[model samples]
Target: MSILLVDSYDSFTYNLRELIERATGCAVFTVHNDSYQLPAEQDNLDRLISSVDAIVVGPGPGNPEQSHDVGIIPHLYSKYTEIPILGICLGFQSLCLVNGCKIRLLHEPVHGQVSKISLQGESSLFAGIESGFDSVRYHSIYVSEITDNIVPLAYSEDGCLMAAQHVTYPHFGVQYHPESICSNMGAEMLSNFGELVQKTGQKRVADKHLLNVQPLILQFSSSKEFDFQFEKVSRKETLSVCEIGDDFLLLNSASVPGKWTIIGFPEPNTSQLITHSQSSGLSVGVWKGASEAVNQDLWPYVSRFMAERKFQPRIDDPELKDCPFMGGFIGFISYEESAPQDVEPITSSPIPDTKLCFTERFVATNENHTFVVSIRPNDDLWIADTTAKLNTLNPSVSASNIPAKIEMPDKQQYVESFNKCQEYLHSGDSYELCLTTQCKIHIDNTISPWEVYKSLVSNNPSPYSCYLDFGDAKLLSSSPERFLSWDDEHCQMRPIKGTVKKDSTMTYEKACKLLKIPKELGENLMIVDLIRHDLYQMLNKVEVTKLMSVEEYHTVYQLVSVIEGDLHGSNYSGIDLLKHSLPPGSMTGAPKKRSVELLHELEHQKPRGLYSGVCGFWSVNNRADWSVVIRSLFNYEDDLCSTASSRCFRCGAGGAITVLSTCEGEWDELVLKLNSVLKVFK
Candidate 1:
């Protein structure tokens, strides 16, 4: 059934929408209080109300007395009398005012964390609620008394009206904010209202409700190996297949399956497909896709296939080309694949003493630009369970779907941790500094590494460099500063050293003065010298392409200089060069090993991972292109917590610190760099 939500602000409306959708499993349409463009107006609100089963009024920061100006309650109640109407917070106050009740401003506002509420009766609004329910309070006024037609459902210990329902009309109101996380039984409360609306609308009458089934658990015996066998049958010849490691096979069908069909294929990759005749005790069944195709008629066929095979299916990646079996299909029998089986098991041995390695390879290069790629495998692997751990150590590289180990932290905890980090910086505990340098050379701005970034696209622009389009062998970037570039015979590296205000108020002379600071230029030149030395090891001759020079980029001006050299000998592979010179001198400070050592000691862990690590791709012809992956996010398969940004913030300060850097200045710089990355939220 269609549900209409009325609210003024976007955030409020979004929260309400999320709560209702989660509770009812129904599609909800938002009607902005200020949306005059909606076809339904005061004149025809009755007709519009007649079209829907229920109306939900959301909470917002506004005076309830101004209801006449907005004409929301009048429009809804006047139009539909028999329909279920749930008013939340401000909406609740308006119901009281319009129904001849009195609202008085409280001497003390109830912002949050008030006492428990006591219900007078088991009203339909509080049908499933326990005796004393806790709810988040955020109101400056309270209803003194209920109108004659309204029946009170719940109230605070002090008798402040918290919830009430109209005796005759299907109208309800709640003074507490139920859509917030702080509200007790928030989702259940909304679900209660949803059931009322669903019953009134008769949207799913006669349809058998699907029960939520528990996830299946497989037990393994002494033999680790298992497999399943099936027949492969298809209506069409050509098909798209995706193999996700040794786990599952994704087959795309060209035509929809009309009846149950057996799919036969090769034995499982890792284990033998056990036959159903074997007494190994295994079962398989299909489930309809729970995502976007939930209500689609085609899902049952897909669900049948899954039920028969006992395989969980994932939504197809939309970015990839569509295959034939996208809508739905039928598939074959299966057997459990045996786990690993070995006559002789290898003994556990101590991990060999080896240094964690960082490799930076040259992906693509031009006369004036070069793309350097680096990978920190662990950053993409480690998963944090708690918010506290995420706050203490910032991770550089991360993978998507990594389940957050910690429960969701409150907003106040986020604020406290953030402020504590700031306090530490202000207390001279650490410094904010980037070891950076750049080259002075002409470049094809269109083809420069910075120009091709994904974040630089017109739809979602970013403040940092990004990688945009990658087609076959060619790659594109939109970097503000030149990192490194090279050709077949020669290579060059340029690092950004200093940053100045972007506004016109900061003159070039002032920028130059700021650039000359020992802490700023000193670290920058050191990195430049390091890059020059790294290139010299692989080149026959090396020289400064251009000394320190100034370049204007997006939000700020930068000091950049160039160094170039010819490839030393034929023996040098791009991989060799990357192995020797990794993590570019610009991101890590001078004395590369020492800087990294200190960073590990001062920061959370080693292997900056993806944050400071690089991302891009290699080409078939060995002409590869990649970016530093700064201002980027990693999605993991396991990490599924609500506050993912806390982890993002922890890894954000890795690039700040130098011998000459001050804690306060370093904090400021870190905040500045973070702003460049965090502005995406805005």
Candidate 2:
């Protein structure tokens, strides 16, 4: 189905287009608020309105009583009675004004805030959503009273009419933005509108063609040690590898050359994404990409191609099927969209505005069994190569020496940085700052990326550890913290806050003292709040599943918290969830934007690259899981190291800096976080 989205000059109109298209599987065409008036454009506007199945009047600034504020509403209401129309925010007030109702400025205006709503009764637009839904509001005016021609179906806590339908025509209007992240069940509510469009006999059916691809499956036994598997795989080729637990190893090496490229923007429309996958003729692949900043304009997106399927927002409950992890997209999106519109680039840095890679084959193993799926032939699969490669192992050179003395920020220099963070906190510029430093290690051809990954995992067996070998770039991560995860059913984010490394000099009780420290507790609370705010953007009611608690990792006893909420509706995808919670809070600090700005000014290092970001996968079924890129190492192809005297490797390490942070304490924390990887070199 096609939707005509009337843009009314709101900053969030584009966000609305993304939400509606993804939720309804409809083609949304947008036009400016004044497009109807220009003599040259009026003919085009009329033709577009006639062609579309539905018309959505988007939110905007200014008084709705003024004709110029929303001039398109009156024209559409008078001229088009057959098309389904839904209005939002300012458009809601316009709906009221046109239908002989009253609209007035609210005594207390709402801007970027969540409103608790109470539904009047059963309504088509709010079918699957709860009675008391939490929704986002960005308006100064509201529908104060409704006439007999309009029936109110929902109200805000203050008794203002929040939603209503025209008594005679199939028309609806809402005071809150269902397209917004703050609307907990916004996707579902928006999907209800799509159903209304279908009831109008306007559903567009897509043509289906059988997926053009061959399926390949291979399995490995989990009983084999990871070290053994690593050695065997390294001898063959570079592929993507994932550690699900001590038992499972998933590897993908189905290489289709010249298919990879760097992607910059997030495409949230499922229909367009499906078209991209179908056109490529590969039903499954993984896209590892990065964005300099996280905002509507630029987001990291993973297109998980599943058999070149049509847009399927919801699998009917009676016909529901469980889909195993099919390959898809995953990667990190920085806190900002790109460089600020006017800022200059950091000099001589090879890092581009974005970086990504796509892949289509994988081999998975667990304690009880091994599983493999690849697009390649049987002979090219890992099962055929493992035993032979194992027989040829060289034990003498398996353990390489520490290539060179590692260089890190000196204690004194880091202390100064810590003090500056405190000053920013005191100045009220930021609540917390995650100050980080880089450690460099120079190597030669003798260092094996696979061996390094095996060493890091053995030393620090983390729940979210992973390894990726992109030929020119290699990633070895031992991240314990889960950045976020979402299936069609639920959305979750777990942020790690406090840390205290294990020490023989101190008793376990003394070591646990870090959990009880006021500074640590405060830091945890601040991040928890930040996470809650981020969740509310795309969800309705975020629940703190777990509060401050101590969890033991391989190297540190850490304070962690879990916060989660239901996805707005099945219409929402894993990409939607990640976009709402990019640049994980624990790493970025509280009051996100201000803190990130401070880091840009205070930290002297280049853009964080993949460090402190996240890495994971978005499955073909729209389920996803990812890890914060902390306690991790990413190797970019450095011409200087590859062709010159020695090969240099870089890794980032740091901690959250708050007003309560001590210079010595933060430096100690930084050293402790890097210790697990550092030991590999030792």
The candidate scoring highest on lDDT is: 2
lDDT of 1 by residue, 512-587 (tens): 7887665565445545545654554444355666656666555556677777666544344333344345565566
Q: Which 10-residue span in candidate 1 carries the lowest summed lDDT?
A: 350-359
Best candidate according to TM-score: 2
TM-score of 1: 0.34
Candidate 2 residues lying further than 4 Å off, grouped into runs, are: 1-324, 330-349, 352-358, 374-401, 504-510, 568-571, 639-643
List candidate 1 segments past 4 Å from native. 36-44, 112-115, 157-159, 201-371, 374-682
Using all chains and alpha carbons, the TM-scores for the candidates as numbered come to: 0.34, 0.54
CA displacement after TM-score superposition, residue 20 of candidate 2 (Å) = 25
After aligning candidate 1 to the native by TM-score, how far in Å is the CA of 252 from where it should be? 42
